[model samples]
Target: MNKKKLPLKVLKALEPFVGMQGELFTIEHPGNNLLLVKDKDPNSKFYYTIEKHQIRDGKDIYSVIFAPKNDKEVGAYSTTIGADDITTTFNSWVLFLENYSKVKSFFDDPILESYQAEFFSNFEFVDEHAETNPFQTAEILQLDYLLEHVSTRLIELSDENNREANEVIVAEIAFIRESLTNRSQKWVVEQISNIYAKIAKQGVPFIKEFWAEGKKELIKIGIKALIESAQNLIS
Candidate 1:
């Protein structure tokens, strides 16, 4: 399929969320007139696609579909807005970028969240099995390195004087380590869901503060670590 580069206007609109680093993600035309936007972050493994469709009223609309790269069973999260032409399609994308957080929350809905919980629970089993599987030795080592790196970055993000945030971070890291070590699927699933809910409800905004203050590098490190660990286990 011939790939299409992002339009200048679309890039400008996505700048606030993706930063000025244009090379950090991949943009392609995935054929059938769809534009695929994928994050280059190995940990993220998320992508968005924009397409145009016709409705019963003979009107055209532009829609954006966001989903994780590896998930095949779960349906993609999508939204559509009225658009008369390609320019309007870009405009619709801009509007979506403006309300990105709300769109993200939709993808982070309860059903998908539960799926994530179950995935992580299974991941714990993989971790345990790695101990006896010589073929998985390298991957296990990489997972350990990534988790340690992430833990250090998270600690740096936390303030020693801020008891509350520190407590959350500590609990989160502890749970991560525990889940990696334990084989209790039910408990692991619950813990994963609880931690995810907490982060969604509180962590994003909290981390945004650091991002606003030019702490994006540190934040990226922490996020990368988490993403790498997840990818490693899932792979």
Candidate 2:
């Protein structure tokens, strides 16, 4: 049996509601026992939980919890998924929603506003002569990293005669990829669908006609997710 890979999509989908303080449990991927948690800080003080255990029917049920770091708040939520849920995208999204909903406390609290200030303060040194401001710096660095990632894999797909034009698409993909990750998944999926719609208008023969472009979008979406997941550590 193959161990389930950590659901990157689920992680991203839950970001808005859960923030960086949570964990994920799975029985299908190599990293089945994935835990997404945050370090202790004044502003955002909680460790998200993702735990998996077996049910009476011999199915895996995942439970999500959020516990305050310095306080005595212990909240719990759980959901059980059957084999069918593990086999389809629908189940994946449902599972994500369950995990996300468990951490909704972060969203409901008015104190998060105060934490947001401390959140920025913790990274104050990054602003002090950091050579790159957050916007310009994160954008270029992320784009460059994205370009390198997609180029290595997609350049082989480009026609040798059209390498120049292909390079332009390559650059554009890098620019827009991060946009997907920085915002919401619904936004990113819509963006991806929209770009494909435009490419379809051009009568591109195949999905590969827009493959490189779509990938750029995906990379941006992926990286932003990764950063968001790890934000608690930085804070």
Residue 105, candidate 1: C-alpha displacement in angstroms: 23
lDDT scores in order: 0.44, 0.40
Tell me, by lDDT, which candidate is best.
1
The TM-score of predicted model 2 comes to: 0.22
Off by over 4 Å in 1: 1-135, 160-162, 178-196, 203-235
The stretch of ten residues in a row with the least summed lDDT in candidate 1 is 210-219
For candidate 2, write residues 27-77 as lDDT tens digits. Answer: 112134333443222133334445543455654455544343112333433
Off by over 4 Å in 2: 1-153, 194-205, 208-235
Give every collision pair in model 1.
3-29, 4-29
Per-residue CA lDDT of candidate 1, range 103-195, in tens?
555345565455445435433343343332222334334433544544565566656554575566556656555444432323333444444
Question: Each prediction's Cα RMSD?
Answer: 17.1, 19.4
